[model samples]
Target chain A: MNAIEIKGLQKNYGDFKLGPIDLTLPEGCIMGLIGENGAGKSTTIKAMLDMITAGGSIRLLGKDARESSALLKQDLGIVPDEIGLPEGLNIRQVEKIMADSFRNWDSKQFYDYMKRFNLPEKKAFKTFSKGMKMKLGIAIALSHKAKLLILDEPTSGLDPLVRDEIVGILNDFTREESHSILISSHIVSDLEKICDYIAFLHKGKLMLCDEKDRLLERYGLLQTTPEILRDLDASAVLGKRVTDYGAEAIVARDKVPQSFEIQPVSIEELFIIMAKEA
Target chain B: MKGLLKKEWYAFLQKPVTFLFPLALFVVLAIQTKSQVILMYLPLYFGILPVTLMSADEVSHWERYMHGLPYSRSAIVSEKYVTVLILSVFSMLVSGVLLFFFMNTGFAVPQFLFLIAAAFAASVLLPSVMLPLNLRFGAAKARIALGVIFAIFGCLAALSVDDEGGSRFQLLEKLAGLNISIGALTGILFAAAAVIMAASWCIALMLYRKKQF
Candidate 1:
């Protein structure tokens, strides 16, 4: 079963418009939503979670998102950009609240995550550092026995060490074939480490969505002279930067001549080039 | 619903002073002035407790976060009403006990019962107006609207008073002269307040469903 299926989804904000966006994330796969600030990433996630009214259809866990019944939500673990718990609550208080909130909330798992994350049970949430707060949010999401996780900018503000730790934890969650995740981030490197598939959102439109491996295999960074770059077919060069030393362009692997040397392109480099081209 | 209630309770406890200080002041004033009217304000105070909670939710953005949880919009709206009801009951119990002790000190049984019932009704009636406003325009703007409403009522109340220590006594004399029993009046007030509260819940739920988080 697909974890999420969005078809012709759209939202209008008077000045800016989003979508007619179509996206799919199969069960057991981690799909990374890569976008810059104000690119409608949060807007799309809000629509999928039924937090906002938008046009078109969205199915999550094989159920219509607009229905948004409590039963359906029980299987969804969500970490919004801000961890929205009452700041005055201590970890223990939060655990108690969650236990009552989710029917399948596992206290042992929650506490275990707390210990692993080194979050203090007695410390109020307002006193925790940004990293600790994020870890707690992730712990709550993971302990609820949810089949699908929707994370929005979960790693944006954290340090590299914390981001890596969160990425590793998310990777662990998807070990079970029934578990799936759709994480959005402007921090492309973190998503590159864990996401099986990547979707690029530019402004309010979806620029590209494909398997990470297939994307890397299809695009290459070609470093050659400007004279040679000028001769290259327009279809071959997706985006290019030229200087006195050389010309660097993201080129379609198959479209480029085999005689030219092509280097592997990182996801971050690919996104930057694509966004610049757009 | 339980989870939401628990969170509210925890938040309430976080800064006990905010709730406790007013309660303490009321108790001290009641004792110092030897006035039953001072204690009567307790129910009104409790009735508006949910507004403070709603304000806190806005500050923490919990209102936005809650939409992602496994709760229906109605459940979210119902939780606030439930909290208000619970606080109202607590206020009644506190006032009832205090009034019970004052019964021997010039307060008659019928008068005491009427006061307690009035307090409960007032407790219910105030939130009945405020919660729907809070749900529709949010706590901050709703607060200004509530202040305007209270000011209008205050002016009307002031206008009703006359010389010779005011028309309040004249109104009381008129009420006492009526054939209606205190018990019947109390029952009517209770029922009316409850009906208004139920209607308010429906309005709040409708407004909350339309809210865009």
Candidate 2:
């Protein structure tokens, strides 16, 4: 069964509009939402979580997200970009509060994550550094026996070592096949490392959605003279950038001539090219 | 609901010294003055506890965090009301003890029950007026709005004093002269405050439901 299904989701904020987005994630797969700062990544996540009123349908675990029973949320975990731990409380206090909150709260797992993350249990959240705060948020999201994890920029501002640690933990989380994750991040490298599926959002619109490996296999960066680019099939070009030195364009590798130099295109480069074209 | 209450408790603990300082000061004043009337204001000071908790919630964006949890919006709104009531009742108890001490010391606790009821009414009324504002406009904006509201009330009060050609003391005297017995007046004020609080809870719930965060 699909872990999440969104159809015709849209949010309007006067001059800005985000949506008509459709997405689905099968259980056990990790889907990464990549977008620019104001590209509606957080808005889409909020709508799916029912944190805001939105105009469309969203289903989680085959139940309408808006209509699901509160108990149904026991299997869902969330971590926003900014850690929401109360400034007054320490990790110990948060544990107690969370224990009371979720029926499925695992105290053992909570302590384990705290230990693994090396978070000082007695330190007030306000005193923790930015990376520590993010780690604590992840610990809370994982402590519950959640079947699905929804995270927004959980690792956007962390040291490389910590980012690697977080990515490893998330990769381990999906081993059970019953667990799925939908995460949003502007850090393309992080998403490329762990996400099975990738969705690109631009200015509130979905630009593309495809399997990561398949997308990488299908597209290549072609650098050639502008005169040669003009002769190349326009239908195969996804986006193009013309430079004084040469013209670089993204095209289906299968359709492009083998004689042209094809360079590797990272997801970030692909997004920048498309966004620039848009 | 239990977790929500626990979160508020942790919020209060952020500055445990601040919470205890006011209570201790009020208790000391009641003892030093050797007066039952002084004890009544204890509840009014305790009124700040809910406001403090509200600010703490805002400090870390805890309200937005709550949306991710399984809690319903109504439950979130109801918890603040419950917290205020708890503070009010606890303060009333402490004041009652201080009043008892004055009675034993021959300080003459006149109209004791009425004074206690008035304290409770004021405790409830202040939060009723403040929490909805805090929930709607947030702590900082709400505080500014509250200052404006109090300024307006203060102007009306000053105008009333000027029109009567009397000091604020005379206004107290006028209220003291109301024909009703102290018991009946206390009961009426308590009942009215309770009704206003109930209405305020409804208003706060509506405001919170419409709030994006």
For lDDT, the strongest prediction is 1
Q: List candidate 1 segments past 4 Å from native.
A: A225-231, A242-246, B31-34, B103-109, B151-179
| lDDT (Cα, tens digit) per residue for candidate 2, span B54-117 | 7877878888787777787788889899998988989888887777764446433446677678
- The recovered share of true contacts, given per candidate in order, is 0.81, 0.60
Give every collision pair in model 2: none
RMSD of each: 2.6, 2.5
Q: Please report the TM-score between candidate 1 and the true structure.
A: 0.93
**Regions of candidate 2 where Cα sits further than 4 Å from its true position:** A69-72, A254-264, B103-110, B162-164, B167-178
